[model samples]
Target: MKMTVFGAGYLGATHAACMAELGHEVLGVDTNRGKLAKLEAGDVPFYEPGLPEVLRRNIDQGRLNFTDSYAEAAAWAKTHFIAVGTPQKKGEFGADLSYIDAVIDELVPLLTDDAVLFGKSTVPVGTAARLTTRVSQLARDVDVEVSWNPEFLREGYAVADTLHPDRLVLGTRPGGRAEQVAREIYASLIVDGVPLLVTDLATAELVKVSANAFLATKISFINAVAEVCEAAGADIAALSDAIGRDPRIGRQFLNAGIGFGGGCLPKDIRAFMARAGELGADQALTLLREVDGINMRRRTRMVEIVRAASGTLIGSRIAVLGAAFKPGSDDVRDSPALNVAGQLQLNGAAVTVYDPHAMDNSRRLFPTLDYSTSAMEACEGADSVLVLTEWPEFVSLDPTSVSDVARGRNIIDGRYCLNRQDWESAGWTYHA
Candidate 1:
């Protein structure tokens, strides 16, 4: 199968490369010339583990290519996958669909014959049906079918998730050829025992957002428990360990940390709530507002903890460990770690951040904050150290070595990654 993936951002790029790895010829189409150029040169614009290798290998093998022209992409493949971003609108909770509209507007007019457009982007319910109508209007003598096939790739593990998804979903109208097309596209995974759930378009659109909403809820639920534990002088780690033993509640996102923050969870929940409100079922998702609130509060609470640890934040030197939302990726959109660092900086604290892969992106997002090449360098002359993201290197740091660099041996484990006993044994005041 040969396909063109429009909007070559994180999702698009990964999908394109992974499709090629699945023995399909793929052309990644995007409006961003710089991104297209980088992809053509075998350079990934973002940090996703294992993606660079897959992308480079596929491109080198002549199975993958990139372009910025819609005509070229339309001419190259009859099947198109919409991998564009549906980010939350500014000053609004609903998704801005301009990009999706733009893709259809640009690609449909250029199609001279039959085509199938698989919407791999997370979108509001009913969007696929609406896009189907729009495609029919714009396409010139072309039989274009629009279908919903939302992606479930996590940021750090996008390549693996794409090539070997746990389940494959294809949502289309009655008598449509989208399901057959999807089967052919993901024939390899289907043969590997991956379940394929065929459904109506609306159900497919809801799946991705619902998954993200549930995950956000789970993280916030644990963080809310962490709040109660804080007030009662109880240990969250011990509680998590005991409850996680039950098979019903496995501890995946149960780590009570600074809370969930990435490009997906925050915006997805907000959009879900907004969509529900528009549909007159707003009360059903009211708890998600609390989930959103709990997540945001964790960042503020972390800042408060830092202020208390440092005695006075006015002239404090704080070392922030990890700037990305999580380990293994350089994405910092809505990152709780960076939020904490930015808040501390605003409060007159001189903050230095260190991350294994996110330093460049962190600097781009926050140019004012000081960044260091390594954890030891960031800890130099710091009043206190705060582990915001649970990167492995930060977890295994030698407390004794860090103690020597910092003016004060004060450490706060925001992610609960540090071993308290080890730090305390090194004559450091440890706080979680």
Candidate 2:
């Protein structure tokens, strides 16, 4: 199968590369000259576990290529995947669909024959229908078919999810060819018994937002329990362990920590809330507002716990372990861990932050905050340490050695990743 993925971003790049790896000829098109040049040179600008290798290998195999020209893309393939970013609008909860609009604006006029455009970005419901109308106006010789095919790849596990998704979803009109082609495109993954669900475009658009909303709700639900634990003197880690063992209410996102903050969850929930309100179902998602508030408050509360443990924080050295949202990737967008460090810095604390891969990216986001090359270096001479993100290295740190390095042996297990008894046994005052 030949395809064009319009937008060589995190999603598009991974999708294009993986599609190529799966024996499809894929041309990735992006208007950004620099990104196209980088891709052409086999350079991936972002850090995703195992992505660069797959991208480089596929490009070497001649199955994948990238270009800045939409004409090149439209002329090359019948299957076009609109994989651009539908970022949260500035000062508005709705997503900014301008990039998506621009893709159709640029590509449709140039499309010479009948083709299918599968929208892969998280979009407002009804966008596919609206786009279908707009695209027909742009085309001359051919009619453009628009369908919704929202992607569900987690950032760190994009390749595996794309290659072996738990399920494949395609939203199209009744008796549409888009669904059939999508099935063929994902045939190998489907043959392994990956469930495929086809539905109307509106339903498909809602699926991505709904999935993200559920995840955000789950994380906030556990954090709410953590708040209860704080008041009642209960250990959230122990409670999470006990509840997690029950198969019904599984403990996947039940980590009672400074809750989820990444590119997806925060924006998606807010956008969903805003969209629901527009759809006159505001009451249905009002809980998400509380969820967002609870998640944000944890960062502030974690800072307060650290300040209390350190006595006066005005001149105290605080080491914040973990700057990324979660480990395995350097991306720090809407990072809860970094948010705590920033708040602490504002309250006159000298905060030194560290993450295995995100320290450099963290420094870029907050250059004023001191960054350390190693987790141990970060903890050196600190009045208190806050385990913000549960990076494996932070979890495995020897509490005794950490205690010896710090000015005051104060540990605030914000993520509850540490063994509280071990830190206390090492002569450290623990606050979680």
Candidate 3:
């Protein structure tokens, strides 16, 4: 199978590499010259575990390659995967479809007859159906078919998620070539018992946002419970454990932390709300606004707890552990950890931040905060340490050693990743 993947950012780049690794000929297209240069040099722009090796191997084997030319991409593959970004529109909750629209506007005219374009980008529900008509009008003497196959891979474990998805969803026109081509493209997953759900374009487009909204709701649900736990003097970790035993309420995203703030979740829910409003179903998703508020409140509450613990944050030295939204990937689009760190800094706290792979990216986004090469270095003589993001390194940190480094022996377990008993045993005041 030969495929052209548009947008060589996190989603597109990972999809291209993973597709090539699946024994397909892939050409990744992006307009960013620097990103293209890096991809051409076999370098991944972001940190996704095991991606660089996969990228380098596939590129070396001549199966995965990248170019900036949409003309070349159109000519190269009959199956074109649009894995572009649909970031939130500024000042509006809806998604900005300029990139997806641009892709069709440019590629439709250039595509030959008998081509199928699969949009793997997460968009509003009606986008694919609209794109079908949009592409038909734009195409030059070509029968262009549009399909919605939303990508379900999370940032940290994207490669694995893509390669071995829980289920494969496709939204296409009735009995179209897109469905047949999609099966061929994902033959390995199909053989491995991955459920392939084919539906109308609207449902397929809604599926990705629905999945993300579910994840966000789960996190917010537990965080909402965490609030009750705080009031009732109950531990959220224990509560999550109790809830996890119930098969009906299986605990995957029940992580009670500073809350979810990744590239997905926050914006996807917002866009979903805006779309519902536009569709005249404003009351359908009114709870999502509350969900978003709960998630945001967790961050604010974390800062308040830290400030209360440290007396006056006016000149307090605070160390923030884990800058990335979550571990395994170095993306901080709406990172809760960094947001709290920045809020703390803005309120006059001397903040020191640390992450295994997110330091450079965090520093670029937040140059004011002091960054250290090591977690221990970040904690060196700090008045208090905030375990903002739950990374394995932070979770596995020796409590006594970390307490020994901090000036005040006080730790705020923002993500609830640490054991309170161990920190207290280590002569440190642990607050979760």
lDDT of 1 by residue, 360-395 (tens): 999999999999999999999999999999989999
Q: Which residue ranges in model 2 land beyond 4 Å of their true spot?
A: none
lDDT by residue (77-116, candidate 2, tens digit) is 9899999988889998888899999999999988888899
Please report how far candidate 2 places residue 125 from its true position, in Å.
1.6
Q: TM-scores for all candidates?
A: 0.99, 0.96, 0.98
Candidate 3: stretches off by over 4 Å: none
Query: lDDT of each model, Cα atoms only?
Result: 0.93, 0.88, 0.91
Worst lDDT 10-window in candidate 3? 397-406
Ranking by lDDT: 1, 3, 2
Worst window of 10 by summed lDDT in candidate 1: 303-312
Preferred candidate (lDDT higher): 2 or 3: 3
Q: List the residue pairs that clash in candidate 2.
A: none
TM-score, model 1 to reference: 0.99
Rate residue 313 of model 2 by lDDT.
Answer: 79
Deviation of model 2 at 81, angstroms: 1.1
